[model samples]
Target chain A: AQSVSQHNHHVILSEAASLELGCNYSYGGTVNLFWYVQYPGQHLQLLLKYFSGDPLVKGIKGFEAEFIKSKFSFNLRKPSVQWSDTAEYFCAVRSFMNRDDKIIFGKGTRLHILP
Target chain B: GAGVSQSPSNKVTEKGKDVELRCDPISGHTALYWYRQSLGQGLEFLIYFQGNSAPDKSGLPSDRFSAERTGGSVSTLTIQRTQQEDSAVYLCASSTRLGGLFFGEGSRLTVL
Candidate 1:
């Protein structure tokens, strides 16, 4: 079975601090990766996605993720985070199984950015 | 609708009662999915529907949980004799041709 692991459960960072949330998946086939964010009192929205091509994918709100195939990792990063960036982040992967493809999500990381 | 929509944004029901949650996917989307979010479990995939048929119902936890999509548009999840442990936020998402999904606001079900 395919599974996603997020190493950080909660992260507290001051405004303008660098951010990196670790995400690793267990799969051997071709995969599509994604990062979703859930702001307080809001629905989950796509932050970024990595299907093919370049390893580095930039998303909305100054977010970016890198898909390192060798490490089986797709980590989310931000050069400098703001107070408004406080939200729960989820890392997901959809493995291609010939026909049945389903997305599996990690436990999620709660990020608290202090202003 | 411009985006996915879920009804009864919040629902509270007694244990052993039945509950039905509705989800209307985005227009022209052919794929729909159901997921559950809980404090303990985070997020989990419950089912996926392609058109009006379900190709994957493997994530459903028990026989009491069932779901169906009709007209390839709306979906309803039914839970019979709901248990307190079943309390969680039920989320619906839709996609086109196996691409990124668009999620609804979700329906929070509290079993007391």
Candidate 2:
């Protein structure tokens, strides 16, 4: 079974600090990577996705992730975080085998930005 | 209506009782999915429905859990004789053939 791992369980940082969340997956085939953000009292929304081509993918809210195939990692990063950025971030992956679109999500990382 | 819609945003039921969670996927979506998100845990895939084909229920945790999609649209996930361990947020998502999933607010189920 394929799985995703998020290194950070809970992260607390002051506003304007840099943010980097680590994510790694266990799969050998071609996969689609994604980052989903769940704001307080909101649904899970797509932040970014990597299908093919460029390894570096930029998403909304100034978030970007790099897909390192060698490491089986797709880490999300933000240059400067804001107080509003406090939320739970999830890293997910979907394999292309047989065109099965079942997506697997990592145990999210809870981020709290203090003002 | 607009995005995926899940009914009963929060549901609290006694252990051993049955509970049903509803999901209304986006219009014209061909793929619907069910996932469970427990506290401090990652999203657990429950089932997947694509078009009129048989659903992929491989992810369902146990025989107590089952789901169905009607008319290729709305879906219902029913947990029979729910246990306390079944407490989690049940999320429904829909997508186009090759599009990113659009999720609902999710239905929080608390079994006590």
Candidate 3:
């Protein structure tokens, strides 16, 4: 079994302020990491994902995450956030070793961006 | 379908009543998942279907909750004798073996 842990439950940031949400996972084998976002009154959509290759991965809306294997972390970061970025973000993981293993989600971080 | 589709966008039912939520996955997706999203709980996975067979149903909260998929396309989640605590958004997502999920708008159920 695999699990995800999000360090922050809620985050408040002002417009143009930098943001970082920490995420860690517990899995012993190969895995695929993902970041999903849900805007107010909207469905959850993919922000970004890391399968392999470079540690840093860029996503939509100028968001990015770095997969650091040593720390078991894949933290989401934004250089400058906008008010429209307010939403709930979830970190998820799936086992690449077991194709049947279902993806697991963290508790989620609710981000509030002030104008 | 162009994307995952869930039905009964909103449902208000009395306690003890039964409810059924439907999910139609994106065309040709081999993996389908059902999740429950409540305030503060994030996404609580309820079940996973690989094709028409479910391999992991451990996330289902209770026996009153049941789900099934047919022809590897449409899935239905049934809650028998629903309780007030069962009120939440039931979300359905579809994906390939290694692809990210494509989520539906979700079916919100409110038990009174």
Candidate 4:
């Protein structure tokens, strides 16, 4: 069974601080990685995804993630954060070969950005 | 086409009752999915549908949970004899192949 793990359950940081959320998956096959964000009262939206390409992928809102195959990890990062960035972040993965693959999501990291 | 849409933004049902949650996927999208998110447990994949076929039911937590997609477009997830543990927000998402997914606002179910 494939699964994703988010190391930081909850993180609090002041504005302008750097942010990084750790994500690791348990799988030994071709995988598609993704990061989704949920605002205070909005639906889950795709931040970015990694199908096949460079290890580092930049997403909307100055967010980025690096896929490290050796470690089975895809960590999300943002050089500078804002209070509006306070939201829940989820990491998901699906096997590439599976045409109708079921995406497995991490428990999620709740980021609270202080003003 | 519009993104995925779910019915009954919120549902409150009594225990032992049956309830159906609906999901309308984007037009032309061949893939649809169902997931549940509890307060702190993150999102859990409940089912997946591709062109009216479900190749995987392994993610379903129990026999009480079942889902079906008709015409490869609309889907219904039914929970029989709902329990308090079944309380959570049911989310529906659709994809244009295996790419990024567009999600609905979700239907929050509360079983008492």
DockQ of each: 0.74, 0.88, 0.88, 0.87
Off by over 4 Å in 1: none
Per-residue lDDT, model 3, residue B33, is 95
Per-residue C-alpha lDDT of model 3 across residues B81-100, encoded as one tens digit per residue: 99999999999999996689
Model 3 interface Cα RMSD in Å: 0.4
Write candidate 2's Cα lDDT for A1-115 as tens digits: 7889999999999999999999999986899999999988888999999999999999999999999999999999999999999999999998876767678899999999999
Candidate 2 segments exceeding 4 Å error:
none
Residue B109 lDDT in candidate 4: 98
For residues A62-111, write the lDDT of model 4, one tens digit per residue: 99999999999999999999999999999999874455477879999999
- Residue pairs with colliding backbones in model 4 are none
Q: Give stretches of model 3 more than 4 Å off.
A: A96-100
Residue-level error in angstroms, candidate 3, position B27 = 0.3
Q: TM-scores across all candidates?
A: 0.97, 0.96, 0.97, 0.96
Report the candidate with higher TM-score, 1 versus 3. 1
Candidate that beats the other on DockQ, 2 or 4, i.e. the better one: 2
Write down the lDDT of every candidate, Cα atoms only: 0.93, 0.94, 0.93, 0.91
For residue B87, model 3's alpha carbon misses the true position, in angstroms, by: 0.3
Ranking by DockQ: 3, 2, 4, 1
User: Of 2 and 3, which scores higher on TM-score?
Assistant: 3
Taking the tens digit of each residue's C-alpha lDDT, what string does model 1 give over A19-92? Answer: 99999999968999999999999999999999999999999999999999999999999999999999999999
Q: Write the per-residue lDDT of candidate 1 for residues B2-111, one digit (tens) a residue.
A: 99999999999999999999999999999999999998576899998987555599899999999988888899999999999999999999998678989999999999
